[model samples]
Target: MSESYEKFEGLIPGDGHPRWGQSYYYNAYDPVRCLGVFIRLGFLENQGEANSWVIVFRNGSPLFTRTNLNLPHTLARPADGVEIAGMRIHAEVPLKRTRITFSSPDCSFDLVWSELHPLADCIAMTQDKDGAFAREVAHIHLEGTSTVTGSITHRGEMAALDGKGFRDIAAGPRNWDALLHYRLAWPVFDNGMAFCGIRGISTAGGSAYMRMMHDGEAWRRVTAIEDRLTFSPDGLAVEHAHWVFTDELGRRHEMTARPLFGWLFPFDTFVLREHMMEYRLADGTIGYGLHETGYRLPWQGMAD
Candidate 1:
């Protein structure tokens, strides 16, 4: 399955839209060490530059962060991998295996991702009168769960990481300011169940994209999602969240999220608050992954 679309598309000719871009995001968490890392590498060929955002967390606080929005980049995908700002994401075997590496004055890492499941395509079902899919979220988006193992050296202290992780790649025209608000969750359970869902509101309308992979089963599209969330006093972070996803087979799967720690990344249009959450299923199964929300700026809290 990966043989078809795993290769990077690089920058394709667009309709001269400034938002034409391609990006890849990779995340890993070491449950034993309570450490996690998030990396987003993006290229805006129309603008002739790229962006690299890397954040490392320990015990719920940011240990290291690097955000470079203005950096030289290549117009096409390099044979080795997508290298920018001293970071690289190379596909060792398309979707089956990948190698990620980075180096800096204070921190460096070499991690390998081995997929536990095949890549799942996020096909949006909601469309507006103008026929926009997921409010034109992305032309192509794919996500999956994996087993990550590597070593990270920070401040001369090396830590061996072995745990679960998640990754996604997206490409096409994307306007960061198009959405008024959004909520997303991707939890990979220890029992082999994984879910990836999102609900976003835009001027066009509300859009939903959901997919889940059951243990030893193929990915299934979720028909509907009932999302509920609780926020901190500042409304900038999530206290907890509950969600009921209805799969195509008419089965309801419920899950609860309790955030362990969170970090914020602010953009001109919105502030992305991301948390490494501890998740619990109705059946008492526990897991870990990312729970993220996007709110438009000026610091207004979550809508009532």
Candidate 2:
């Protein structure tokens, strides 16, 4: 059952958690067009509240940015797709492909995302410490490729965008501050290589994992908990991301990623700092991806 993807994986259950519901997230960057975007929608099951955040960037500068909490929202599945406010997200091919659209009086997007590789299966996030709560949010990681062909309007400036980007859908509780800290990154290069890495600390414990897909075969599965990434002085505001890791085949992979432009967002649950970076490898291969840092718990203040 876990082999093939499921359409409902992208949709919400009829009734959700009472305290905090789930969220749907997706982000992408197409370097050629100098375009980048981030979107998140969260539903609070018990409270009947919905929260959302969105940002669109051109040449590393924000073109549109907005964050709203407990907004009066009506989420419904017209047929099988999910709709909130004026946004519509429908899975066109079960787990394989999806169409996401947002059209409000102020902002809009028309984009399609196709799963280019299988997501990591759900796993235990920690062996000790806050293992149970940690597993609640860090269960699975879904990675995909996106083609964004839309114009986002903000402050009366509209920009046309086209780019290749990364996205994810994780099934878990929506308690953002409950998490300690973690980072997830996947880069789909022009030369046809898709790579992903994730790791973080839970109150009880922590975990790290990595995977790569190339030449049309499933990702090699093994314990990949040895990746290391270092940042510059300004951290999220800077372009430096030095990465080194050993793959499943005992091969060393290393690269330095630099951002063309940077973006910052202090969301309701947590704060995110991002660098839409292009990477340089040992073999002189240059590729595009993102460098990001997230702060959970104390890093964010209580929602006012």
Candidate 3:
């Protein structure tokens, strides 16, 4: 697969399906400052709508958040940048390096993301082209771990941003109503090892759609994942977790996590609770990233 493909670089013109959509997402957090930033730009081409979200959190609560769930899809795709829904995502090196900027009354940030590892093709982890799990998610998914550096101004105070980050591009039909419940975790450790795993219950049954990792040397697809998570009293965020992953080469990796901060994101048919967590490997190296869970709206049933 070529990384320079148009679909990987920016928004596709249109795929004809009303449900077809594409999204560019990025996040980075500083453990010392207990601060985190997450940004997303989405385009629903067939529907002629766009969605953008910018959220910054201090300690454990949101300092500023700008959510534009629907806006006229007046998007501009420059040769090296993307402008949509009040945000500019400029790529200096396509998928390897990016500068994302946003400005609003309450908050603003200009952050640069540099990929530290090769992009992972999440769909390959499924090993099935026509599987039920693949159909429910999307047709394309690419992700990478990155190092973030820049600055953010929130409520009149500016702060330097230095932290490990994660970015991903997803496209195709994402039928939210197909999922009953799902959990997604992407953690990058201090030693350079990282994991991205997802498991869910869909109408067809249980499936693990994404299970891959960077072992500091190379990327490998994990054969199985066993995860146990405990949520907060309100069941809206993760409190603690224990995970075990079995790689294709037959090695067992284990880790545990405790939440540092959490935020809730709701859109369309799902409510997502994204947690910034501090994780400890069995050997005791600490790391940070996102632990997210998605639940379908109880009122919506599976596609018939």
Best by lDDT: 3
Candidate 2 TM-score, true structure as reference: 0.77
**What TM-score against the true fold does each predicted structure earn?**
0.92, 0.77, 0.92
The predicted structure with the larger TM-score, 2 or 3, is 3
| Number of clashes found in candidate 3 | 0
TM-score, candidate 1, is 0.92
Residue-by-residue lDDT tens digits, candidate 3, 119-183: 77777765755665467666777878999989888878999988988888877876777887788
Candidate 2, 1-304: lDDT as tens digits: 2654353354455334444355566677777677878777666656767767777778768767777776664454322677665677776765566677777666677777666554444232112223443345533444555554566665556666666666656544555565566665556666665566655555444443434443235554333444445544544454466665555567666666777766666655676766678877666677776666666635532111
By TM-score rank, best first, the candidates go 3, 1, 2
Candidate 1 per-residue C-alpha lDDT over 223-248 given as tens digits, one digit per residue, 9 for 90 to 100: 77888999998887899999888877
How many residue pairs clash in each candidate at the backbone level?
Answer: 0, 4, 0
**Residue-level error in angstroms, candidate 2, position 106:** 5.0
RMSD of each: 2.4, 4.8, 3.0
lDDT of 1: 0.77
Worst 10 residues of 2 by lDDT: 121-130
